[model samples]
Target chain A: MNIERYDRQTILKEFGMEAQLKLQAAKVLVVGAGGLGVPVLTYLNAMGVGTLGIVDNDMVSLSNLHRQVLYSETDVNKSKVVTAAQKLKEQNSETDIISLETYLTPENALRIIADYDMVIDASDNFPTRYLVNDACVILNKPFVYGALHSFEGQVSVFNFEGGPTYRCLFPEMPKADEVPNCNENGVLGIVPGIIGNFQALEAVKMITGIGEVLNGKLLLFDGLFNSFQKIRFSLNPENSKIKALQDSYDFNCEVSVNSITSDDFLQLLAENEIQLIDVRTPKEFEKNSMSFAKNIPLSQLEERQDEIIFEVPVYLVCQSGVRSKKAVNKLKEARANAELINVDGGMNEILKHAIKY
Target chain B: MEILLFGIAKDIVGRSSFRFEEGDEVPKSVLELKQKLNNSFPDFGKLSSLAIAVNSEYAQDGKSLQRGDEIAVIPPVSGG
Candidate 1:
């Protein structure tokens, strides 16, 4: 170990050489390599965490550059885990950075998480959040949790020293369309940085026993108002009694919508005169869109239902595939017989093929 | 009673905070508060995993509310 590299932190009265050694011996796993994961991994590695693991199957896209500052413009379209691991290793050579280019699914979550001393739930979806909570509970591992929505962000430490778990606060996962994610609802670029830094601080505290960990407390930050609030919660004994993982954490089970890949949609467009609706905002539509696609943003779909032809198969698309699925659900409520097919991967995937508008 | 809204609740109500004035029919419990919000904004009922905090402490559905209590409605946010 390079003893002089960490002189500043170890020199502190509260955090002595003992704490530095603890950080060096810890093995932390960060679940996402996006906005929140960047700060958590960066700070933890810079602080000399001995072993770090990154899990993410997503590739860096142009949209992610706003908040996921770790990746550069040149790094776009590259694997996030691979890119992050390479940069993190450059920041600190002594730290062992393990990159797993895969999404956290029910089949592999337990196996991947069992090897780490603690986990950082930096994933960007509800299914992965619940899966991390259940897997940590089942394996008796502690994890630091962080999430964001628009201008507000949340941070908490779950399953740490008998503290409250994420399930103890929000017992059930929200339905697929109940709440909008960062992809649908915009988030300030700095919000994730602030929330992720909080997560890293809590993780350092938990590992080094330097200060009071955010055990059983959820910290909410509203950047619009520049205010912070902490909600104290207690553990539900039943939550810790989770003996096994659920068969599936997917909340989209209720509504079944047919989906076609972007490539297949392109093929169909060439062969037939198909009806396609771009469900993104007007600004997004103006930026780039298929010439055949009609603009009917998801927010205004209700009032513009008459503009769509229900007799034919109507395809829905957005920046990503999420909002299009929501549009399908909304359209189904109004016209149950309408055949709505969501374009999987949306424009992001279509752009990959370099097809002309 | 003053109610604070976070995440989707804030968007549903179209504001950060609101007050249930003395002359209004205020909710007496967490469950009633949620019902009141759901009655006003139907979207509130769609969120299956909403949490309520009273005076910075997590409250159960049956927990009684007082006129001066500070209540916050927090919905799950799935962004990183």
Candidate 2:
């Protein structure tokens, strides 16, 4: 490590030559290339964190340019990781940048994260977050979590040796609708910038072995009021109960949970009072069945709408409530008169509740 | 009774640590306490949809609160 390159940072009492060397030797994997990931990757690369892995499956959209400062107008429609990796490599050729142009599925999670010393959760979805946390816990690696919504941001370190885990803070995940993403609810541009900067600081701190890391505490920040607070939580023993989560099983489980419950909606079908529409794949319908439902999957719902009579309430059922709700919302939006009722518990929950039905 | 506070509620109350009566409930309904605290202190009125947890466990809507509970009035949680 050349002393001149980090002269400004080296002179600081806390971060000296040894800290720079630690940063140079550190290998970090950032899980997203949007919003928070941009600033985090930038600062980490600028500080010379030796090898950086950027993971993302999305392409830059016009809307992404607002907070994803890494991409330019010309880079729209380009793979996020590719563009991000290129830009970051240009910042400092000495810092090696590798891009994974795909989503972080559970199958590849451990493999991708195994090589990195520390991981950062900058992804935007619950499944990804849970997957990342579980993978981190299993790997026994410290993961710095950062998320921004509206004007608020949260930062925490999960599975840090004996520290509290994400499950300790939130034992069970909420319904997807309980929290909306930035694309749906919107967020301040600077919110991620601030949160991402904090993530970079935490990463640097973790690497250099300086400062009190956010081990067992969760830090929340409010941009509107400029306030900060730290809440402490203890590790939950039950987190270990989720011993192993395979890719297929987890994906199916998530989809099933999101699906409408059969018990709640099947009663209507058992009495022949309402019409049930199976908006799932033919294979899904073959595997599961409602008492009296038509096999018009969502792919064909639009063209085959005439096949089902409009005399009764059309109860929509899919693998999860997501597609069914979307179908109902779309039907309502199109001014369709058939009564639209979306079963809350999708097919998976429904079957669990009403196995005989 | 002394109950330590954290998150946005601490800032609203003006101090991170404070004392209050245990009240009637073992874990008092956060809504009722929020109203009383706002009426008495008047500043916490702006905090709404804030989650309440006692001793680090999320509290039920009408549960009674006890003394020494680590009361945290969390702003909308945005953690990943």
DockQ, all candidates in order: 0.91, 0.17
RMSD of each: 2.5, 11.6
Candidate 1 CAPRI assessment class: high
User: Could you estimate the TM-score for every candidate?
Assistant: 0.92, 0.67
User: For residues A225-323, what per-residue lDDT tens digits would candidate 2 score against the true structure?
Assistant: 787767766677777556675554232253332233456455655566667787776766776677677888665777887887776677787754555
Candidate 2 reaches a DockQ of 0.17
Q: Report the Cα lDDT for residue A49, model 2.
A: 93
Error of 2 at A189 (Å): 0.4
Report residue A42 deviation for candidate 2 (angstroms).
0.4
For candidate 1, lDDT tens digit of each residue in A246-348? 8887666567778999888888887899999999888778877989889998889999999999999999999768789889989989998888899987887
**Candidate maximizing DockQ:** 1
In candidate 2, position A29 carries an lDDT of 97
